[model samples]
Target: MQVTALYRHPIKSHGRECLDAVTLVTGQTIPWDRTWAVTHEASKADAAETAWVACHNFMIGTRTPALAGIWAKLDEVERRVTLTHQDLEELTFCPDDPEDVAEFLNWVAPLCPENRACPTGIVTAGTRGMTDSDYPSVSLMNVASHRAIEQAISGPLELERWRGNIWIDGAAEWEEFGWLGRDIQIGEATLRLREPIERCAHTSANPRTGQRDADTLGTLESDFGHQDFGIYAEVVNGGEIRIGDKAVLQ
Candidate 1:
């Protein structure tokens, strides 16, 4: 298989940006992936806490599908992010700035439903990125598996719903399931497959429309007999990975 695409979500459940290439670091997430996560009113975390934690403390795309409509591009040099959504005007500001934080919170308010927990704060837990898993991990997805899902659903679906960090093509459908604890090399990086990623309702939400139009979980259970779509991997050896880089199981 080859690397078909690369993506990173600077803010968890906020937006994803495409990358042509990136340098992977050992025991780290995709560069800037989930670096800034929004906390909700329902969270039980200490405001000052700064370490990788569970997903329940954060507001994510699974619960607020409308947030899926947000798209983002990060200015790494400026330490700022430019965000765009259909319902709101474009905004660009540094997330670490108090003034910008307040502006961003207000700007994103309409996208969040009134009935659900409102976004209350922005939090970061160092550089590991707030991946759902306890360990610093990257996600790998197979295009063939995604196609299988489309076949099962009998409809078109966006792969962005999966929010993967690295996407590979040319592998057989569900081939990744067999790679648990196996070593795979992509470009100059060597990653150890940790486990299959049991999915959530987040996959049901369309990234472009921010609508839950598909029963992804149902189709997975019925057709595949499992509610998994991807795999989590730890970067055992860090290196630069680019589009079309070969992925080989070793």
Candidate 2:
């Protein structure tokens, strides 16, 4: 298979940005994927929780569709996050600092609070916290698997519905279903397929409009034969990967 598309959230549980190509460092995408997250006060206060940097734990997908449209850019050097939308230009801040982080959280709370309430703190690499998701680092999916789901739905599906860091093409439809426990090579990077990604209420939330589709989970279950799609992977080797990178099944 070939690398079809690449994406990064910058902030967890927010919208995704498509990339023509991406450089994979270690097993994760470089400088863009899940580098920041919004955290609840409990998580922020817990100095022992290193995994609180992931945003999936605190952000509710069922309540807010606007979360899907958020685009992020990360400046790794300066440790800054820049968020942008159609009407809004880039709003920049450093997630590591308490004051700046709080300001950003307050700024976006009104944007998505109607759908779901966000935590008061923003977490990033600079912060000692971790993401809310089960995984420590990244998420990935196969294009072939997505195509199978689309075929079952009898229409086109938005890639944003199932947000992932990497999108690989060229595998047979639904082939990713068999990849659990297997290792795959993409460019110089190596990833071990972990488990099937479970569906959540967020999948029903449209990233572009923030509207929640109650039937999304049901549709995945009824058509896909499972409430799960895509595979979670852990990076075994860090390296640079780009679009068109060969994904060889090892």
lDDT of each structure? 0.90, 0.67
Please write out the lDDT profile of model 2 over residues 1-250, one tens digit for every residue: 8887787776776556777765555534345566666655445433412443334345545455567666676776897777776544557887777888777876676566643455766545533223334455456787877777677667677788888777888878778878788888888788888887787777776666566644667777887678887777777887777888898877
Instruction: Rate residue 82 of model 2 by lDDT.
Output: 77
Residue ranges of candidate 1 with Cα displaced over 4 Å = none
Q: Candidate 2, overall lDDT?
A: 0.67
Can you give the lDDT of residue 52 in candidate 1? 79
Q: In model 2, where is the ten-residue run with the lowest total lDDT?
A: 45-54
Worst 10 residues of 1 by lDDT: 41-50
lDDT of 1 by residue, 78-130 (tens): 97999988878999988778789899999999888888888887888768799
TM-score of each: 0.97, 0.83
- The local lDDT score (0 to 100) that residue 142 gets in candidate 1 is 95
Q: Count the backbone clashes (under 3 Å) in each candidate.
A: 0, 17
